[model samples]
Target: MTVRILVVDDSPFMRKSLQKMLEEAPDLKVVATARDGIDALEKLEEHKPDLVTLDIEMPRMDGLTCLRKIMATHPLPVLMVSSLTQEGAQATLDALSLGALDFIPKESSFATMSIMQIQQDLQEKVRRLAASPRFHPRPPAEPPAVRPARPAVPSVPISAVPIPAGTALPASPTAELLVIGSSTGGPKALQDILPALPADLPVPCLIVQHMPSTFTRPFADRLDGLCQVHVKEAEQGEPLKAGTVYIAPGGIHMLYGARGPKGCVELTPEPVSSLHRPSVDVLFQSVADHYRGQVLATILTGMGADGAKGMEQLKRKGAHTLAESEESCVVYGMPRAAVERGCVDLVAPLPDIAGHLRRHFRL
Candidate 1:
């Protein structure tokens, strides 16, 4: 199916470049180009495109403003085009919160990279998003009351008995660690799930959301602000703590080592063979090695099979696993792959995920 798109950017050169790249794939059709947020709104009405590729920094109305307007009225898939800068990362996250579906990060050295690679990445995102246009759970009309993310909770035991293939334990309420992986549609998916987690959640959660190094800090900060669970980018050698969500830094792998109730962070830059830097497989494998039967792993929306193998490792180690069902996933690749591998114990829709987690850990 051809995914109709409108490219919105203030830069003429970038707009044309993106257009040429997208046209390389027959499935992606650039229906119009908008110079800024104002132009984007006008073109949205005129073209009625299936999706929009929006640039965050634009004159005469920024991408965030345009995104708010679009999500309020038209509510189409909008992918933010962001730069790999601190400021760009923060604004792109703002776009996500305002209901942008996904994002593509641009580097300052974009001219130095191969356009072919960019074309493939861009087209793939467009194809996946247009194919699955279900809306994410929108935030409420009024903000939910802000409870502190970490309230004191009772300690729970960690099970050591291994769970066999095709088997799952009932919700233990004692799961000691929670790890999550996502890519294409993560930010919005997380928005739906994280805010609903109980303030006194007992597990320490680590996340590997496929994003640029520049983006992770701001993304974590944004989630921290909005979520009942405290969120932050993982720091090397920091001990794991309950009720906090640690996002893997963008360019480094977040591996766990010397496991216990108090596990220390282990970051690595080697083994750059994977498609993503803070690889889901790397993190999952590390957790499976140490946490074993005490773990609870979740695979959310993404475009690749990065987490499948590691999820398999976790499953083999008796960890309970959950995969987002296809109906709720924006791009169902990672979770589908894990499901195909027989690694997943439960298949739940996006909105039910928070409840599933709560019931599992009895938080």
Candidate 2:
């Protein structure tokens, strides 16, 4: 089936370039091109394309404003065209929280070293998003009268995990370390689950969310302000500590190493052949080797099979494992792989994951 798309950008060259590149795909077609958000909105009514590729910086109405308006009015899958700079990363994340499906980085040097890679990546994301049956638009948000509010994730209380009277608790909670991996739709999913964790969490949490180097620090800061548990980008040689969430920085692999008696973050550039630099498999395998059965691992919404092998190893070591159910996943690729590999112990919807964690760790 042909997936009709609307390409919105202020640059005439970019619009033409994107249009030409996208139409090269047999199943993809650019139905309309808009100069800016206003033109895009008008085109929306005229063409009603299956998807939209929106530029973040535009005149009259910016991409974020357009996104808010789109969610409020016509709601559909929107992919952001973002720069690879720090500011671009922040806006891309904001777009994701506001309901964009995914993003393709727009670099100034695109025509030089990365054109083919970008084209392939963009086309793939467009196809995957267009084919998803479970895409849900967020509740209508009016264009913010002021700066947008940080997502106010409701914290999960200890009482929320109901234990029936006389029910035997595990002799000991199975995990001492918590590791999570995701991609595609991870930021919003992590926002939902991480904030629910109490400040007194007994285990240190490690996360690998496929992202660029410019984005990881901002993403961690964004989560830090909203979550009770402290969140920060993982640093080289930083000792692991309970009650903190350490996000693996992009562009490098995060592994575990013993610094005297404590486990510390070890950033490396080895395994240069991995599909992703900060690969979920790398981190999960490190944890499986170091902590073994004393780990709680989860694979959330994503678009690849990166975490499956590592999760399988974790399961063999008796680690407790969970996956976000298909109904709650935006892409369901990573978790589905783990489940199919016979690694996942439980599959629950996104909202219930934190509760399950709390119950397992007896938080």
Candidate 3:
């Protein structure tokens, strides 16, 4: 079936460029175009496009407000197109929280960039969103009944302080940097893990969760509110410090870089590498290059094999690599690929991954 899409943006040039890129795909059709969110909503009713390419900064109603309205009413898949700046990053995050499926960063120069690059990304994103299950908002279900508690494991110190109860304590020689990569099901999975980390974790963390712009900041804020550790969207040249986690902003790739003695994080808006912004491969390879033996790389639930080669690189560099066991992943593609490539040193269930980290640090 041909996938129908609505192109929504205030910039006439952007709308034209996007429409042109998307229509080039034989199976994809641009059914309509809207200059702003209000117009898009009206067109949404008339055209009922299967997908929407929305811009964050539009007049007469911003993209995020429209996104919330869509989720609350129409519930169709919406993809945000944003700039690669701090404001754009934050707005993208807000849009995700409002239910945008994904996003793309506006190319700085249509003239300089190759059409192939635009076509490839636009096609992939639309294909993925088209394939995605429709959004269904249901009233919250009651929490599952609590089960009997298991006997607690003995506590250990990862640093100067004793680890908190329920937290996985890394054994001596604990990792100085924890690197994580995830895609589908990542936001929810992160909700599970980040809050469980002790507030006094000894190491800083870097994460690459495949998502579009306007999503990561909200994810970070959600984690920050739930976890004791400070969580923030990564900024270029930001120092990797203990008790904090840096999430790679959507619509860009984040990589580890050197800043004097300590490692730092950098975000790039260069063309998509390995089929994704915040690509797992980009982050993992950089971690392997910079931190090498001291890094603990975890491949979480995601689609595709983006992280497999990077995990291999990490393993060869003597870093400890962990893959989420298939039984626990929302989609087992990434970790499974890593395991098959013989790059993963260990496979652990999601709930037990923290425990594994603790044990690996132990002598």
Candidate 4:
């Protein structure tokens, strides 16, 4: 099926470039382009495109405002295009919370961007969003966003289920550390899970969220304001402390090591060549080596399989692992990959994850 798209950006050049990039995918067709939010809505009603690539900064209504209005009124998958600056990062995170599905950052000049990365990312995201059953179907007048929510993964019952044959469920450890990794739909997913965790959570939590260099700090700020647990972007050589959540800063890999006998975070100097700098695999591998059997790793909703190998390593080392179930995932790629590799001990929905953590940690 042909995937219809709407390009919404204030710049005519950007709109054309984006259109050109997207249309390069044989299955994708950019049906319309808008100069801003108001124009976007007009085109939205006219074209009823399968997906929208929305720019954050625009003339009248901004992307965040438009996102809220769209989610409240139209209810379709909207991916945001944002600058990679500090402000851009915050707005992108805001857009995500307001129901934008995902985002890609544009650097100083949109034209100077590495087209190859943008092209690949654009094609992939458009195709994935289009494949969803929620995209526009035959009935033109029918609403797109009025679909029912998927059932979350059921909570871990009082009496745990038997372990599947080959993998041994680690004897429930008095979990000392919790490591989390997410991307794409991560901000909202993290919001759903993090705030609900008790302020006195027994272990320190480490997170590797895929974001741009300037975005992680603002993201942490937002999470800190909302969550009971103190959330901050992780820093180099900082000692790991309980009851606080450390978000791996963007553009660097976060790993675990020790300062003398005290366990501390190692923020590396240079960015790795991996697709993601704050790679989940880097963090998870560190946990596998340092925490071994004393850790609990949670893989949340994201676009790629980054955390899968890391989760596998954690699982093999007897760490308890959880993957968010598909019904509760905005993008099930990461969790699905972990489950496929037999890394998770349980698969829970977004809502039940916190409770599951409490139960496992005996909170």
Candidate 5:
């Protein structure tokens, strides 16, 4: 089935470029184009497209306002077109928080007529968003007024079914470090999971979320304010500490390593051949090398098989591994890949993941 798309951007060149790129794929069709948010709304009502490619910085009604309107009135899959600037990064993060399915970075001035990267990213994201049955706007989240105290986790009876969908068996206490990987619908998923973890978590957490370099810091900051555990973007050479969540910055790989007396995060661009800069395989394999059976690794929602190989390595080393259940995943790709590889120890839905972690870590 051909996926109908509405392209919204103030730049005529960008709109044309996007339309051209998308139409190149036989499955994708640009049904209409809108210059700004107001026009985009009208186009949305008129075209009722399967997906929308929205630009964040537009005159008249901004993309965020338009996205808010879309989610409020008629929630659908919306992919944001964002610039690589810091301001653009902030707005894109806001858009994701507002329920955009994903985003593709745009260059300033739309100078390049033929952008291979943007074209490839646009086509893939649009098609996936259109075809995904799980694609739905995330419910709007009100930013917490203040950093919240750790919410209490109520105890439940241990179930005979050891790996039930919602319940978790007590996890082994030997696991010392926690590493998580996600993509596609990860921002909202992370928001759901991270804040629920107690502030006094016994082990440090490392997260690899596929995102642009400019956006990671802001994303981490947003999570920091909302979560009980201290969350921040990982800095090179910083010691990995318990009760802290380190988010890998975009455009680079983050790995586990020791700095003489303390274990620290090592950011590198080597093996630049990897598909994703902050590749899950890179991080997971590193943990497998250092901690082996002492690690707890998870593959959350994402678009590709990046983490599956790493999960296999971890599993061989006796690490406890979890995959987000399909019913709870936005894309179900990464976790599905890991599960198919026979590496996942638990398959849990999004709401239950943090609880499982709490149980495993004895938080």
Candidate 6:
């Protein structure tokens, strides 16, 4: 089937370029091109394309604002075209939270990149998104009847297993950091886990969620408001602290490392590895290298084997590992891969993960 696309950008050259590129694919078509968000909205009524490729920077209405409106009114899948700068990264992430499906970097030389290479990437993204199910805007479901909030409970530290002679384990449980890897249904899964955590939880949580840049901060902000713990986008050399969650920003990798007197989170602008920025593998590998038995690795719902290898590293290093079970996942790919590799120490449903975490920490 032909995948219909609406191309939205302020640059006439960009719009034309995208149109030409997409038209060359037998299974894809640029049904419409809009110079900006207003024009895109107008074209939406006329063409009803199956997907949209949006530019982050635009006059009158920016991509994010347009994305929010699109998600609210139309809810078609959108892939953002963003620059590599920090501002662009932030905006791209915001777009993701606003419900854009994914993004491609709009480098200054993107136009001159091998047309064949660009075409291949564009086709893959468009086909994947088009084939994926779309999220429709719906009224909020009524909340379940309120019950008494669970009382705060102190977490008991799990007895640390000794690392191998060559490996390292932190001297205290407080020195350990939790590294979480997730994708697909991660945002909702994180909401379920974080908000239920007590204010005094004893370890910092570092999360690698498969998402574009601007969206992670908003996702973190949403978590911060609802959860007892503080949530923020991870920064370079940021010290991990108890009762806090750090989400890796999109378009960059977040690695675990020793900073000064202790281990902390580090951000790297490394080229995409394993087809993802903020790769689960990079985070897991780093944790294994630095924290060894002090790490707790959990692989959640996602579409690939991105975390499986890293989970194996963590398991070999004697860190406890968990996987979200099949019944609870939007896609069973990542967790399933980890489980099959014998890397998962336990498999639990989404609702049960928090309880297991509480039990593990003895909270």
Give the poorly placed runs of model 3, Cα more than 4 Å off: 107-116, 133-177, 183-196, 209-227, 232-242, 246-279, 282-296, 300-304, 313-336, 339-363
Give the alpha carbon lDDT tens digit for every residue of 145-202 in model 3: 9999999999895644211223333343457788899986566567667777777777
Instruction: State residue 7's C-alpha deviation in candidate 6, in Å.
Output: 1.7
Compose the digit string of candidate 5's lDDT tens values, residues 57-155: 899999999999998987888999998899998888889889888888888856744577667777887877776546644566888798678988998
lDDT of 6 by residue, 1-363 (tens): 999999999999889888888888898999899988999999999999999999988999989889988988888889889886767766765676677766777877876786666676777777766655344323567989989999889999886532223112222343256789998767767878988889888888889998667567767877898899899999888787888889999889999877754468789877554588989999888888877447778888777788899989988977777788766665567888887787776777788888877766766
Which stretches of candidate 2 lie above 4 Å from their native place? 111-114, 136-172, 260-262
In candidate 4, stretches whose alpha carbon ends up further than 4 angstroms from where it belongs are: 132-171, 260-262, 269-271
| lDDT computed for candidate 2 | 0.87
lDDT of 2 by residue, 1-363 (tens): 999999999999889989988999999999999999999999999999889999999999999999999989988889999999999999999999999988888897866664577788888889878765456434566785777779889988663322122222233556778899999889989999999999999878899999999999999999999999999999999998889999999999998775634488989998999999899999999887876337888999989898989999888888778888777787878988897787777788888888888787777
TM-score of every candidate relative to the true structure:
0.86, 0.88, 0.63, 0.87, 0.89, 0.67
Please say which candidate is ahead in TM-score: 3 or 4. Answer: 4
As a TM-score, model 1 comes out at 0.86
In each prediction, how many residue pairs overlap at the backbone (N, C-alpha, C within less than 3 A)? Answer: 1, 0, 7, 1, 0, 9
Query: How many angstroms is residue 134 displaced in model 4 relative to the true structure, after the best TM-score fit?
Result: 8.0
Worst lDDT 10-window in candidate 4: 160-169
lDDT of 2 at 132: 55
Q: Estimate the Cα RMSD of every predicted model relative to the unseen true structure.
A: 11.3, 11.1, 10.6, 7.9, 10.1, 11.2
Q: Give the Å error, residue 319, model 1.
A: 0.8
Ranking of all candidate structures by their TM-score, best first: 5, 2, 4, 1, 6, 3
Return the lDDT, model 6, position 167.
19
Candidate 4 CA-lDDT value: 0.82
lDDT (CA) per prediction:
0.85, 0.87, 0.78, 0.82, 0.87, 0.79
